[model samples]
Target chain A: MKINRREFVKRMSAGAAVTALAGCMSNAGRPAAGRVVVIGAGYAGATAAKYIRLWAPDIDVTLVERDAEFISCPLSNLVLGGSKTIRDMTVGYGGLAKYGVKLMRDDAVAVDPVKREVRLASGASLQYDRLVVAPGVDVQYDTLPGLASADAQSKVLHAWKAGAQTVALRKQLETMRDGGVYAVHIPKAPYRCPPGPYERACQVAHYFKTAKPKSKVLILDANEDVVSKKGLFMAAWNGPYKGIVEYRPNSELEDVDASTLTAKLQFGSVNADVLNVIPPQRAGNIALVTGLITANNRWCGVNWQTMESIKVPGVHVLGDATLSAQLMPKSGHMANQHAKVCAAAIIAMIKHEPVNQEPMMVNTCYSFIDDKNVVHVASVHAYDASEKTMLPIKGAGGLSDKANELEGTYALSWAKNIWADMLG
Target chain B: MAVAVGCPLNAHAQDANSIRGMAATCANCHGTEGRSAGTVPGLAGVDKTQIVQQMQDFKTGKRASTIMQQLARGFTDAQIEQIAAWFSAQKK
Candidate 1:
């Protein structure tokens, strides 16, 4: 019973067209129809909103975001390294409008899952049949000492969100002396991007090696070692960046003197011309307010099958906000994968079709070791029915053999292709 | 010959959405509907057998790539065949 590819597509298209026409007719007759409201216009939310509109045009989909433009955090380190600019990374939401997704330029202050309403900062409330929340992560600055005051915190930039703070940190780096020390403090596991701080270290080191050869990059890591692509990162640090980058493991940042650009470690303190304090993070603030942080009160927990909150029905969590199964990296690519699985499930639920039981996702993360050398880690994950979680499919993916100039070229091409897929 | 190679994929038409969902992940790098907008080769309209053979080669490390080798190993033979069929059916 084999079906040819052409026959399959033809049948599927015919079925879809007929179903969609019926859905449109029904939607036109009903004044109040199915509406899905997505919070946060990020990798996950944007993809979910667009796909929902593309798959189920009868459903009213609205994407609520805090900013007018989306700034990618994936390649933001290049901005700090002077290889890219904020403008180059920022994209407007106008492109999503073509998919019939309404863009709401406002912050989602509160979510009433039981009431099926989201209250916005602009004194407006949106009702939803289903809600997709992808608010990313919120850094806890209060956990770090000497960063309680707005004035003090201004000097120590995280730049993890990839917007104003990114520009500020880049500017600070530009103003530093040729031989100055640039310090970066990384929090423990489950931060936004697993390989981000290491990649940042590499990018900054590359900058110093070329533009400020005498300067140095000091990486203060709380983790035991580089969490992702450790071998590759270690090779880069010991090889091309031997003299420029200094990596210290188990050096958790206890406090900071932003005024003096001094990091207070358990053993001692180190002063730098510029400091980047990326504090411990949890799910976005809205998730906390909505009681979605069911796992250790740090991240939202959802069923791996549908990405729907285990505690709240009809509410889904995606991207960095969710406590995914072990071995899942909190990455943009994973978020995009979550969006597709979630979108498919939501569409099926609305149309009374059987949701796909076996969902497979793939993630590939690239790290720029230098301006021309890049390394990567990739894996495929599949839902385990018995385990009730997504686990890596062994033998399907691994780290790059080594960082190389060709990977660097692929890294750029990857960024361009992904951004177009998400926004174009 | 190409059409014959794609026959096995048609049996799983009931899982069309799942197949499409998995294939969509490739678009992040391959381009929308596999019509690459960059230097990465577009998969749309490529021969199913060619796509399947290349993926198998990548999985086996016969074809060296910065990322594809690792990515190719993510799927089983059947899944790879289905993905190849999906893209091969797309317009060039």
Candidate 2:
């Protein structure tokens, strides 16, 4: 942001004029103070926690995550297909302790909304003046007739939650035969990273393009097409792994006849040496059992402006768990954006200041097609008057149907810079 | 009666510019103090009051945003607090 050019000088002059026009009466008082407890540590939760720590130092901040190490779902597909490793993607919370955060490594068994206390599995309760929950998304394996659970994940690899399953899936991919058909079974809607399955196909195809050219991939997407950059990924599929990648859409996978080592689909039963099943998903089980979600067990509805739970008072849900009419697809980027907006409203409440009932949101989703090939879709929008949301600025940013040198270079540069932006 | 344009960049930049200067990118999209006017999100207003909690999410990779994840890495706990304190000081 160093503006040294003549253009910069002109802008600075204009900035001075703007400043003079509005007398410099800015934030003149101490910021309101209170302790905030953040649960979960995924994109929305973690981003909210990090920004909270950076922005408010005096307010004692406590972060509770069930796990010690964090592995991301964003680049996780890369690991499954073998473009990246768990070591490369794993993260630690040691840094948060230095920033005045009390980091607790324990499962939050129950959130007592009435008492404003969270009871942990360790039998300890922590009270918070304000609470933030960004637990990310939870997979509803039970929805599927025969799907893998925490106990059965090892037998069949989902590789969706990160950690051991990621390792297991990679191992399975390595052991598959050169000419074997690797089937990737993608579920229906309301899952994390809709573009994820295609990205995994691209990364794996990148591997099979060189290592096992004869090996084939069968993608069973239960949709019309794999979302975002569908055209680009398909073009790559045709160019590099023409015979290797086979994409099948609107083909829903039914019960897995594991005895046959094949997925039973509506079209037909397809056999494979490896089965990568992305079971249907919903909000975390806690969100469902605790009455945070509707009977559908999909998501909880919230006031777009408040992010307050429709069912309860003083309860806010962000990230993939809460249902928003903003039409924001479930992604970490959207969750992070929503978390900040919600946090701002909460802060206004603490300060006893006039809270803006109307707030806008920003979202940008990027998928790494490979080390070089990536696709991004960005939008800038606010909620409409009906309390529903739409893009105010339509088509601010989206993927280019045809890739050029500049788009490729920017996508690569963006990957590097975004990592810097999020966790550098 | 003056408002800071951005976070104090020079406060502790001797160690790692990447770590300390991370939130600045957000300020570009978000506001300088993160009190953005609905264009994107006001990072300072809410998350900061919780302090290092959100940063902890970024640190652990529990949160994954290509931008914020890179921004959160390679920092000590003390630096996380310093930046949170600095931004929380601004107007909501």
Clashing pairs in 1: A3-B10, A396-B73
The iRMS of model 1 comes to: 5.4
Model 1, A242-324: lDDT tens per residue? 99999999999999998898999999999999999999889999889988899877999988878899888999999999997
Fnat of each prediction, in sequence: 0.68, 0.00
Q: Best candidate per lDDT, number?
A: 1
Runs of candidate 1 exceeding 4 Å displacement? A1-33, B1-14
TM-scores for all predictions: 0.91, 0.74
Q: Model 2 reproduces what portion of true contacts?
A: 0.00
lDDT of each: 0.87, 0.65
Indicate which candidate wins on DockQ: 1
Docking class of 2: incorrect
Total backbone collisions for each predicted model:
2, 46
